[model samples]
Structures are given as structure tokens and as C-alpha cells.
Target: MAKSASSVDWLNRVFGDSKYSDLTIECGESTWHVHRVVICAQSPFFDKACSNGFKETSSKLIKLEDDDPTIVREMLRYLYTGDYLEQTKEGEEGSRRSALSTNVHIHTIADKYDIPALGDVAISKFSARAAREWKTEAFAGAIEEMYTSANENKEPMHKAAVAIAAENAKTLLNDDCGQAFRKIAEAVPKFAAELSIEIVNMKEKMPPTFARYRCPNSMRCNKVNMLEGLGQASGSRTCTYCSNQYYVNVWVSKKLDD
Candidate 1:
């Protein structure tokens, strides 16, 4: 069911005003005055923590000293609103990379707190940011974080990363801009293997006309190798503009010419 605007506003006010708040969630020096019904209903960990026999049941407080305060705040926000805005730290406040990192952290922490829906939301946000910023250094950092984080629900995030990397292989594997990407390929064997498989799968579905190759003489060479154009079956072709020879593959319907 869709939530009414008034209800969302009321909930936001509850979170903001702390009206009749029954539970206090403390992370580092920060605290969220929340309610048991609102928070516990969505998080199994919090539900268990606030159940009878737990000290928090009587104390009405849960301390999360180990979690990042910014992440915790976003988590609380999601519990109330069913969504969260990116909350990057000072230096990174507006950058897409920072937003990507925030989503990655939220995914892992959502898993930690047994909030599967929140984990899914985090991955969705992570993927959107990743698609836009895959060429940036932030992508490599996010990949490392995704692999290193102790989260069990990683397959969706893994597929998203590998897909982005596979689709942009020329820039991600051959260009100097991809140095960090190459380093990540070396550091994470699992990611490297998954990316290789995705690349192979992508190639199997691609048509011959989609193949592209750079002319040896110039960086500005037209990369398109559409069969309908001057492109032909594999052999040496001299660049008309640069007079340099380069190899092109037909990839289908023709044999390699000597």
C-alpha cells in the first residue's frame, strides 16, 4: 500500500521531534530517539535486542559504538521513511563516488542488522551510482570495499560491478585511466574471474558489426568496424588518414585473409 503524505510527514516528525520515543539508538557520540515499534519491526537484530530478558529491554537504549555514525543515521532514516538520502562526510558531500561508498557501507551494515529490505535498497542505490561513476577511481575503491566487507548478500552487488566493467573493457583494461582497475583485478581473484566470464558472455551475444579496433597510427582512428562499411574479413588494413597498418577481425561469416 502506498503511504499517505501526512503519514510520512508524521513519521518524519516522530523521528525528528522524538515524540514519545521509547528507544534510543546510540552510535559513537550520536543518538537517534526512536520507537520500538518503528525500529524493531524492520530489524531482527533490534527486535532481538529489545525483547524481554535483554538489558536493552529495560534500559531502553542500544549502543552501536563500532558502526559509523553517518551510516547509522541513514539506517535510522530508512527505518522511518523507507528510503535514505546520501549522507557523505564533509570533503565528499556531493561526489557520486562518495555516494557509492555510502551505499556499499549501508549494504553491509544492513546485512549486519538483519534488514534484508534495507540491504536490497542499498544495493539498488550502489548500482545506480556505480553505473554513472564506473570510470572513476571511486569505482575501484567501492569494489575493494564490496569484496572485503563481511557481508553474505554480495552476489547482486558482484554482478552489477562485473557487468559495468565488462561493458567498458577497452577503457577499463587498456587505458592508463584503468590502472587502479588493473590493480583491483590483481588483488581480487574472485572479481577477476567473474569479470572474465561476464566479458565472454557479452562477446557471445555481440554481433560482428559491433566489433571495434584501433588503428595503429593514431588515437583518433574511427573504432567502428561495421561489416557494411570499408571493414572486411581479418587481414592488414592501412589507415587511409594515417597510412599505418592495423588488423581487423570480421568475427563472423568470413575467414581470415592472409
Candidate 2:
């Protein structure tokens, strides 16, 4: 524990002070003064950037392009602390949405920089935040960005976003944030199809207590009266909507009584 505390203190000092920093990393108009050793120890991209043959080695300056400065700052923080700090707002909902958006951006940056551990950390945070903030517009944007930028199968964020979207299909497809669903459909047709199928399957597979039984003609059926008459027996019920027959099998769990 003493060694761990000492290491934390060392990292804090290194991140907090620019006194011994030998390198300057510029992103857009923003400049960050940092230690080359600290960055190189954590990232192979920096390892090569600070090597003898690189221009950064001679000038001790590296300029990054096409990267958000906010995300870059968090990336540096993760490099030093092994965790990225989330900035929260006044409202709980707003803060959570902001954190989710930031984590998605950080994950993208981490992947771009080949920092797998940092990417994993960012995605873990993103997944947790997403579970709470999935209904927000920020989550929609994050999902759009994740599908458009990140590797679809390799990134956990993509799958988590899809799962949340699937579970909340009614809200996501019909609400004000329906544009996100449309964007996903346009950007990734295969994923959109899969989500649609999952949503249909979910509605169909729901228990009688929670689900509205639908007839072949898309009309709601009185499942309770139908089930009461055919207790413990498998039979076909005629749909009142279309007069089509469908089979119904009831399976009650013994644990339901407990």
C-alpha cells in the first residue's frame, strides 16, 4: 500500500507540474507541456515520436492533428493516472449524459492512438454510463459515432449501444430521438436489421403477464380468458382479428410461487 501511495503521489506531481517536462504536445491552438518519459513509457506512438530519428526528438515538440483537445487531455490524464476523470454538470441527468459522451470520444481517441488499455477503460466507463443515460440525445450521438468510427465487432461500446437500443426500441424508434435510429439504419444496415429482429423477438417472447398477445392480423387477443379455458393443455386458438389459428403452450415455473 505504501508503494502504491508513493506511485500515486509521483504521478500526481508529474501531471500537476511542468517544471521537469522536456516535451511539448500541441493540439490545435492548445499546448500541453509534459514529460517525454512519462508519455513514452505508456504509449508506443509516443515512443516512436520521441525516438532519435523523429523530428520531435530534435525539437522536443509534437503536434497532433484531427484530434479533439479535450479527448487528448483526458488521454494524457489516463496515461498518468491509469484512469480518466469525468467532469459532471449541475443536473444528475445532464452530468451522466456528458460523461457518456466524453467517454465515447475518449474511447475513439484511445483506439486511434493504439492504447488498448485506455480504450478498454473508456469503454467500461461508457457502458456503465450508457446503461443509465441511454435515453438521452447524447447517447444517440455516441452510438452514431461509435458505429461510424469504431470497429463494429471489436468494440464493446457498439454492442452495448445496440443492446440498449434494442431493449428500448419503442422509445428509440418513436420518440424525438428517432433520428438516431434512422442514422443507425443508414450507417449500418446489418446492425439495424439485427436490432429490428431482436425487438420483434423480444415483444414476441415476453411472458403473458407482461406481453399483449397479438393475432396474425395484428389485433390484441384476450390471452387470459383463452389460457383459463385450456389450463395445462396445448391447443390452437383462433384469432378473432383474422380467424387464423395459432398454437399456445403454457409453461409455468415452479419458482413463480416462491
TM-score of each: 0.78, 0.68
- Give the per-residue Cα lDDT of candidate 1 at 170: 81
Among all candidates shown, the one with the greatest TM-score: 1
Candidate 2, overall lDDT?
0.70
Per-residue lDDT of model 2, residues 24-82, tens digit only: 98887778889877789778889888996999999999899888766787798877777
- Return the lDDT, model 1, position 120: 84
Q: How many backbone clashes does candidate 1 have?
A: 0
Per-model C-alpha RMSD: 7.8, 8.5
lDDT of 1 by residue, 1-258 (tens): 335788778788888457798999998878888999988998989999999699999999999988888788889888888888765556743334477778888888898999888888888888788788888888888898898888888888888788888988889899988999889989999999999999999977865443333444435754333232234456756555556565554223232232
Model 1 quality (TM-score)? 0.78
Q: Write down the worst ten-residue block by lDDT for model 1.
A: 249-258
